[model samples]
Target: DAGVTQSPTHLIKTRGQQVTLRCSPKSGHDTVSWYQQALGQGPQFIFQYYEEEERQRGNFPDRFSGHQFPNYSSELNVNALLLGDSALYLCASSFWQGYQPQHFGDGTRLSIL
Candidate 1:
């Protein structure tokens, strides 16, 4: 089965600009969660989407937003990006939900210039 997928394995952007990353959840998953992973650090949850609505949010600011499509795909949008926003954007999904172990894609490596 097709697993989670992300686009633009690497990207470069400047400060104050905006960037949008894409993700496709694993087969049979209904929930999508976005996360940010800094160099050498664990993934930090940004938010989660279920039923086309954001179900949970993390410590990130409002500038970080996301959406989940009916096909179980997801997208992460970061506006007014900053140098600090440079990190790996990851999308993970679970089969049953309720905090189950999620499978991760390699991620989109975003770099702020």
Candidate 2:
């Protein structure tokens, strides 16, 4: 079965450009959650989408937002990116709520250049 997938495995951008990262959920799964992991840090929840609605959000600012399509794929959009925003964008898929241990992809390594 196809597992969770992310695009542009690595990216380098300036300090003030908008970026969009993509993800496709695992086979037969319906939930997607986005996380930001800074260098040497644990993953921080950005937001989660289920049933085409944003079910939960983290402490991030408005610049961080996401959308989940009916097909169970998702995208993370970041506007006016900052140098500190550079991190590994991880996409995880679960069968349902946060109670389950999620399966994660290697993630897209975003670097602010």
Q: Highest TM-score: which candidate?
A: 2
**What are the lDDT scores of the predictions, listed in order?**
0.91, 0.93
As a whole number from 0 to 100, the lDDT of residue 3 in candidate 1 is: 84
Q: Which 10-residue window of candidate 1 scores lowest in summed lDDT?
A: 93-102
Provide C-alpha RMSD values for all models, in order: 1.1, 1.2
Which runs of model 1 end up more than 4 angstroms from their true locations?
Answer: 96-99
Give per-residue CA lDDT, model 1, range 17-80, as digits (tens): 9999998888989888989999999999999988889989999999999888988888999999
The sequence of per-residue lDDT tens digits that candidate 2 reaches over residues 42-113 is 999999999989999999999998999999999999999899999999999998945787888789999987
Model 1 residue 87 CA deviation (Å) reads: 0.5
For every model shown, the clashing-pair count is 0, 0
